[model samples]
Target: MEQDIANFMLRAAKFEFFLVNRDTSLVHTKVVGVFTAIIGVNWTKVAQFVEVAFPFNTFDFTNSGFEIFAQTAPQYLVIKHDGRLGWDCDNEPIDSWDRLLTRSYAQLRNNVAHGNKHQMPAPFTHDRTAQFLPAGLALMNFIANQVFLESDWDTPIFS
Candidate 1:
């Protein structure tokens, strides 16, 4: 798990590099392949992992202009939706900011993979890549922390 997390971080860095030098569609497609493995199909572990820091009231989605969540087919929805990406959610909408972030990421991956690029969500779009990258990276770090509590993840990679 530790090595896998490290590989994910390295792949994320590569994603940024490609975003800088390649077309947006190409970068999106490339990232989908690796990121999917990291997030996995089931989200129960992610939900349990993030329970350590839920609510996320300190993180303001409105101010950041990222909607709490985005779906491919919101119009077909009603009240009480189940979580995706392997989340065994009850008949309730996603309730936490972290889960919302993962869901948004999953939606983006789906959009790219399933040829639904037109349905890509706000924060996951190429235009907002700079703003969204930090949050995604932080979430990746959170996963790493959950897997190996002994590691000093608090230390900055750069000064």
Candidate 2:
């Protein structure tokens, strides 16, 4: 039983890593798409569309404006909702990890899309480039653990 549990944990860790990488890649692609849309066209016009889509006030181009937009981007909405629901239900909040990962990715996307050349913060800073992999892995582990625990493995593992 002990060996089986150990093996399961090891496999879970590997699977979690894989899931995180995949999720991060997907999020990164979405962020890039949003960034591209913003850059490929007039930012003022794009900002208007973003405002309407998100139903928020216009984002100022100032540093504080970027900071606010970074924190409240729609990409992190599901994570935030999950975190709130988890708290309301008295469950452990795994969504916080997702939010963190999303924030890291969003910041990177924002900087690149906005043409900022400064270095990003630590945990995100890697070899002078932003590194979002760690946060992504953490979020993946949280989600995988939740799913594994809640799932009935006794049933067929696949369809």
The lDDT values for all models are 0.39, 0.32
What TM-score, computed on C-alpha atoms, does each candidate reach? 0.35, 0.21
Q: Per-residue alpha-carbon lDDT of model 2 for 1-159, expressed as tens digits?
A: 234334434443455344434333222122464363211212233223333433333433233212322343212111244453110111222122233223443333433333222332233222322222233233333333443332322223344
The top-ranked prediction according to lDDT is: 1
Give residue 158's lDDT in candidate 1 (0 to 100). 60
Instruction: Output the lDDT of residue 92, model 2.
Output: 29
Global lDDT of model 2: 0.32
**lDDT of candidate 1 vs native?**
0.39
Query: Weakest 10 consecutive residues, lDDT, candidate 1?
Result: 70-79
- lDDT for each residue of candidate 1 in 46-104, tens digit (9 for 90 to 100): 44444555445454445333343422111111133454322122334655644564465
Instruction: Show model 2 residue runs off by greater than 4 Å.
Output: 1-101, 105-124, 128-131, 147-159
**Model 1 bad stretches (over 4 Å):** 1-39, 52-94, 108-126, 146-159
